[model samples]
Target: MKLYPIESGNFKLDGGAMFGVVPKSLWHRTNPADANNMIDIAARCLLIEDGNRLILIDTGMGDKQSDKFLGYYYLWGNDTIDKSLKKYGFHRDDITDVFMTHLHFDHCGGSVQWNKDRTGYEPAFKNALFWSNKDHWLWATQPNNREKASFLKENILPMEESGQLNFVSLPETEILKNSELGFDIFFANGHTDKQMIPIITYKDMKICFMADLLPTAGHLPLPYVMGYDTRPLLTLDEKEAFLNLAANDNFYLFLEHDAHNEIITVQHTEKGVRLKDVYSCSDLF
Candidate 1:
């Protein structure tokens, strides 16, 4: 199986929100903020080339939102899904599955696009079966007040409307033992309800897609959690357990929102799980 890092785009998010209660004096040393106090973030997606299935994990925010809405995030960079796909000699149509980690707009917005007539939305990858777990699907569709802004309807709904939406069925409490794809699935709450983190076996190493579970290497510290998470305390517990497992097994974390660092590994340090080494995804292969 081959894995390609899809560079959808970059955007800025408030550093304070990204690092939760971690003081600016601490987080800023790693994720230095701009003059506006926003830090650079990447909507980096992953493409899996396995057999007849071309699975894409997370579609970055599409260009369908209004300028006003886009302005809030301060979108940056020319990298796009189309350009990224082309770099690998592929096209959006080649994607057979879109495995969404969650339904946040920045993560799944590229799933749908404005139709040619501009009358309504349509599946961005018409032939793809868009995947989301049942719990996350419900959580996003019927979002609570705190998360409503992040779960934009325009980024969702169209997949179901196009008859291409499907769910991965697993016990709410367990990791998916029977993955149809070639990856083991790790379910994480805290960040959001039932966010599926894919543990992919690529080459001789295992790579876990760190979708908000661990946004960047800077987030390796247990106390450094995102403020956006509904259950920050739950996130704390989840991160501790996950990091311990990751450090023991030496799993490479494929970061979704880290702009500079693409992949990272953690070590069991005296201070707790701490960043070990960083690399570009290609460096692994």
Candidate 2:
């Protein structure tokens, strides 16, 4: 199996929002904010090429949202799914499975795009089966007021409408082994309802797709949960358990929202699990 770090795009978000109640004085040290208090964020999706299947983890924020809507996030960068795919000599059409960690616009927005006629929306990957768990699919589609803004209809409904949407069966335990996508899934709920974190084994190394469960290296601290998370207290528990497991097992965390730090490993520190080493995608993949 071959893996590629797809640079979908980059944007800036309020540092305060990214690092919940954590004081700016603390988080700013690792994720320094600009004059506007906005920090750089990346939509770093992952692509896995295994035998006949080409699976994409997340699609990032697509270019279909209106300028006014996109402006709120302060989207920046030239990276697009097309350009990034081309870098690996592939295209969206080559993707057989688009497994989304969640339905947030920034994560799954690129899965759907405006049709050629501009009349309506359509699945971006014509030949791909968009993947989401039943719980997350229901949560996103019938979003609560707290997360309604993040779950846009245009970015979601088209996949189901196109008849290419599929649901991964939720495991009774925390981790689902040997999923249809050929990886283990770690179910996390603190960030959102049933956000699936993919645990992939490649080249004798366990590479975990750390979605919003651990957005950046700065978020390694258990209490440093995102303000956007609906259940911050629950997030603390999930992070503590997951971080300890990652540290003990020496898992390579593939951070999807960390613009600067691509991959990292954590070790048990006196202060609890902390960043051990940073690695470029080139170093591992």
Candidate 3:
């Protein structure tokens, strides 16, 4: 198995929203904000090449939203899925699976694109099976008022309409071992309903796709949950348990939203679990 870091794009978001109730004085130290109080964010997706199956985890924010809509996020950078795939000598058509951690526009938006005629939207990866769980699929499709803005219909629906959508079976326990995607899935709910965090084994080390469960190394603190999370209290519990496990087992966390820090590991400290080390994608994959 081979892993490639796919740089979809970069954008800036309000630091306050990203760090929730955490005081700017604290979070700003790690994730410094610009003059506009916006911090750099990355839609760093992951690509897995195992045998003939080329699986992509998250597609970033596609270039389909109107300028007005995209402007709100302060989009930056020249990275695109096409350019990143080409860097690895691959293309979207070579992807066999597009596994979405959640249906948020920034995570799965690139899964759909405007057709050649620009008449309607269509699946971005023509040959890929778009993956989501039944719970998250329903949660995103029938979104609540708070999350409605993040779940854009143009970024979704087309996968199912194209007859390429598939759902991973929900696990009875916190972790689902040996999933259909050839990895273990850690189910988390605090961020959103049934957010699936992929736990992959490579070279005898577990590389966990940290999704929103732990957006960045700065979010290692249990109470440093995102304001966007529906259940912030529940997020505290999930992070505590997951961080403990990650520290104990020495798991390499693959952060998807951290623009600067690519991969990191945590260790037990007097202040609880804290960042132990940082690594570039090349160090592991």
Candidate 4:
């Protein structure tokens, strides 16, 4: 199996929002903010090639939103999904499966795009079977007031409309062992309801697609949780358990939202689990 880190684009978000209640004095040391106090963010996606299947995890925020809407996030950078795919000699049509960790716009907006002639929306990956768990699908579609802004209809409904939407059946034990997608599924709820984190096995190494569960290395501390999370206290519990397991197993974390640091590993420290090393996909593969 081969894995590629597909960088869709970069954007800026309020550092306060990204770090939640964590003081700026702490998080700013790692993710330094701009004059406007917006921190650099990456819409980093992952592409996996296992035999006949070409699976993409998370589509990143697409370029369909109006300028006014995008201005809020301060989108930047020239990296795009198509360009990144071309770098690996692949195309969007080559993707057979799209496993969405969640339906937030930054994660799934590129799943759908404006059709030619700009009449209506359509699935961006026409050949891919977009995957989202049943419960998270409902939660995103019928979003609560707090999360409604992040779950945009244009970025989501088109997958179901194209008859390409599917769901991974959660196992009774919660941990899905040897999933057909060639990974173990870890269900995390603190960030959002039933968010699926794929723990992939490649070349004798366990690599985890750390979605919002661990956005950046700055969030390594136990108390650092995103304000956007529905349940912050629950996030603390989830992070503590996951970090312990990650530190113990020596797993490589594939960060999705960290702009500068591509991949990281954690180690048990006197304070808590802390960043051990940082590397990129090319360095490992």
Candidate 5:
């Protein structure tokens, strides 16, 4: 199996929103904010090349939002979905599966695009079987008012309309057994309901798509939950339990939003599992 980091580009969000109730004086030292208090974040996706199944983890913030909407996030980057895929000798059409971590725009925006002549929204990868549990689908489609703006209909619906949407069984409360691919699913609610974190085994090492659970090294602290979370307290509980297991088993956290750091380790420190080191994903291979 081969893995590639698909650079879906970067966007900005209020640092306060990203780091939650943490004071600026505290988080600024870790992930510095711009003069406007907006912080740069990457929409990093993972591509799995296993047999004929080319699975893409998440789509980046697509270029479909209006200019005013783009102004808010300050989306700036040269690397795009197609460009990133081309780097690995693949194309959008080659993708066979799109495993949406959740329906948040930044995570799944690139899943669909405006049709030719700007007719209507359509599946970005027409051939890929887009995967999301029924629960997440319902949550995103009928989003709560608090998160309605982030769950843009233009980025969703088209997957089902394209007739390629599928749902994986929810993992049991107990640590899930690996699928045939030798990877287990870790569910966490801090970020979203039933968000699935793929625990992949490769080359005698374990790697997990940390998703929003541990977005970056700066987010290692138990108090660093994002203010954007619907249930910040629930995020706290979920993060602590997940981090403890990750530190104990020495898993490589494959960060989905960290632009500078790709993989990180957590040491069982007095303050709980603190980030031990940062390395590129290539180091894992």
Candidate 6:
């Protein structure tokens, strides 16, 4: 399978929020912040081509929200979902699957957009099957107060309404069986309950979509869990296990939220697991 780096857009997030409990002196070294303490973040995704399927994993935040709503996040950058797709000689409709890591706005917002008339919402990838696990689907649809703001109904419901919404069954007997998608699905609850990280195998290399599990290279350490994670302790456990596995196995981490680093490897340091090397996708392939 061929993988294309599809950059949708960039936005600024509060550095403190991104790196919970971690001091600014520590995180700012890698992800420097502005006067307002906001750091640049990328909604970087991938386009996967295998056989007859063209899967676009996690479209970035779309342009459907109100200006004021977007202003809060301080969205920036020239890279757009359509333009990046065009770079690979593809379009929105060409995607056969919209594999969402989770239904958070930045990850799944671009899956829906305003129809021409400005009257209603519609699926951005009309021909694609919108993919998410059933439990997370319910969590997002009927969001709790802590996550209600991140799970926008407009960005999510349109897929189910379009009759294209489908679930990757997670039976207790076969929980880690890769979710019927070709890639291995790493179920992480630290970010959200049942969030799936697609561990994709390509060209004799293991490329993993480090959804919110490892938002940026700065977040490589096992303890650098996000303040936004509801289950921070669980995140600590998950990161330690995942990072150790990545380091030992020499896996390429496909960072989804880091604006600068595309892929990185980890080294076991005295302090903890740290970034060993940074490279772009082209460098690897």
lDDT of 5 by residue, 1-285 (tens): 888889999888889988988899998888888999988788889998888889899998899989998888888879899999999899999999998878888899999999998989899998888888888889899988888988988898888888988987776683566653346877777677777788887767788888887877889899999988888898899889988998898988999888788889888998888988888977875
Model 6: per-residue Cα lDDT over 74-189, one tens digit each: 98879998999999899888889999999999999999999999999999998999999889999999998999999999999999999999888775631256556688888888
Supply the global lDDT for candidate 4: 0.92
- Order the candidates by lDDT, highest first: 2, 3, 4, 1, 6, 5
Task: Return model 2's CA RMSD, one decimal.
Answer: 0.6
Candidate 6, run of 10 with poorest lDDT: 171-180
Residue 250 of candidate 4: its Cα lDDT?
96
Worst 10 residues of 2 by lDDT: 69-78
lDDT of each: 0.92, 0.95, 0.94, 0.92, 0.85, 0.90
2 or 5, greater by lDDT: 2
Clashing pairs in 1: none
The window of 10 residues in a row where model 4 has the poorest summed lDDT is 171-180
Q: State each candidate's clash count.
A: 0, 0, 0, 0, 1, 0
TM-score to true structure, per model: 0.98, 0.99, 0.99, 0.98, 0.96, 0.97
Q: What RMSD does model 3 have?
A: 0.6
TM-score of 4: 0.98
lDDT of 4 at 230: 95
How many backbone overlaps does candidate 1 show?
0
Per-residue error (Å), model 6, residue 118:
1.2
User: Any idea what lDDT model 2 has?
Assistant: 0.95
Model 3 poorest ten-residue lDDT run? 215-224
lDDT of 3 by residue, 204-233 (tens): 899999999999888998889999999999
